[model samples]
Target: MSLPPPALRALQGLGAVWTAPNTLIGVLGGLAGMLAGARPYWSRRDCALVFREYPWGPGGAITLGNVILHTGASLEIPCRTYAHQAGHCTEPVIGLHDHERAHVYQYLVLGPFYLPVYLLCGGVSARNPFERAADLYALHGHGWWPLKKR
Candidate 1:
C-alpha cells in the first residue's frame, strides 16, 4: 500500500491532541484566575456556599470552597461560580484577567507536555513537580499579573 511521506506523517502525528481530565481542571481555572487579577478572597461563609454548590474536582486543593487551585489555575469562592458555570469567570462573579494570565503561566512552565502527562496519569490529585513550582511562585513571590492580596 502507498504511504504518505515521512514529513507528512510526522506532522500528522503532531496534530494529535490529548485532553485533560476533570481532576486536572482546577489548575486551568486557578491559572486563569491568577492572570485576571480576581481571586475569591470571599468570606468564610460565602466560601462554604461555593463549596457546597460546586464541590471540589480532581487534581486540586479545596478548603470548604474558598479556594481551588490545580496545576497552575484556581478559583476562589463566590467568584468561582461565574467562572465555573459560565466557563468565563469574570469579575463580580469571578475575575478573568488573572485566570487568563495564569493560563499563560501554565503554558510557560508546564509546556505542551504537562497536559498530556496529566491526562495520561489520570486523576489530578497528584501534585507534579511543575505544579509545585507554580504554586510556590503564586504563594511566596510575585510571579505574574492580577496579584492577590496576601
Candidate 2:
C-alpha cells in the first residue's frame, strides 16, 4: 500500500499528543461540554472558559473540575462541572486561587507529563510536592496568595 499523505501522517501524531495533557484533555472535553449545552467562554482573568460547574467533586473527591494552563494566566478546558471559574472575572476558586494558579504553571512546566507528575505526587489532597508548592503560593510569600492572613 502507498504511504499516507504527509499532512495525514503529521495530523496522526496527535494520537500521541503528550506535550500538554491538560491542554489536550481540555480542548477535547471543552468541545464536548460546549456541545452538551455548556457554554465555553474566556474569563476576564485570561483563563480558558467551558461553562461547566466543576465543583469539589462528589464522594469526597477532593479537588474537582478540569482546567489546564501552561505559561500565562490562561486556563484551558472546562468540565461538565466547575473546572476553573470564579465569576465573570476570575476562576471559581476563592481561597485557593493562588494554589490553583500554581497548578496551571505546573502544567506549563511539565506539559503533557504534568498529569503523571501530579499523580505521582498525590492524586487528590495527598500533599504532594507539587500541591505543596501551590499551597505554599497561597499561604506563604514570595509567591503566595492568602498571605497567611496575618
Candidate 3:
C-alpha cells in the first residue's frame, strides 16, 4: 500500500536529511560558481537548484545532490530555440535538467554513498550504470536507480 501524505512528507524530510552532506558539497560548488558569474535559480519543476553559466568542469553540466551546475544559459537542450528538431531530445523534450534531477533522486536514496558508488561505477562514462540509469530516467521518466534489475 502507498503511504499517506504525512508519512510520505516525513520520509521525504528524512531523505533530505540523509542527503544533506552531498547537498552541502553542491551548495559550496554553487557558491563558487556564483562567484564566477554563474546565475543561480530554483527549478520548481526539477525540485533542485540550478546554476547557469557555471565556469568550472569540462563543460556541459554536473549534478551534486539537488544542485545542477550547467555551462549554458538554460537547462533546455537547445538553450535558445523552441523548435522541436529531430535528434535533439526524447519525445517529451527531456533535457539536462531531467537527467540531473535523476542524480538528485539518487542522492536522496543513497545519501553519502552516492559519490563513492558513482565513482566506483565509472565516474562519467556511457559504461557507468548510474549515468545509464540517469539517461533512462531522462528519456522515460523512470529508472533512476543503477543496477536495478528489470
Task: Report, for every candidate in turn, its global Cα lDDT versus the true structure.
Answer: 0.35, 0.43, 0.78
Q: Candidate 2: misplaced stretches above 4 Å? A: 1-21, 44-47, 54-94, 141-150
Angstrom error of the Cα, residue 115, model 2: value is 0.9
Query: Number of the top candidate by lDDT?
Result: 3
Q: Which scores greater on TM-score, model 1 or model 3?
A: 3
Which pairs of residues collide in model 3? none
Ranking, lDDT, top scorer first: 3, 2, 1
How many Å off is the CA of 22 in candidate 1?
A: 13
> For residues 34-134, what per-residue lDDT tens digits would candidate 1 score against the true structure?
56542433333221111112333443234211233432243342223222344442323333323323333444333445466545544233233333333
Q: Which scores greater on TM-score, model 1 or model 2?
A: 2
**Best candidate (score: TM-score):** 3
TM-score against truth, every candidate = 0.26, 0.50, 0.82
lDDT of candidate 1? Answer: 0.35
Q: What is the C-alpha lDDT profile of model 2 across 42-150, one tens digit per residue?
A: 4433223333443222421121123422222223322211222312223333334445655554554456666776687666542456654565554442342222243
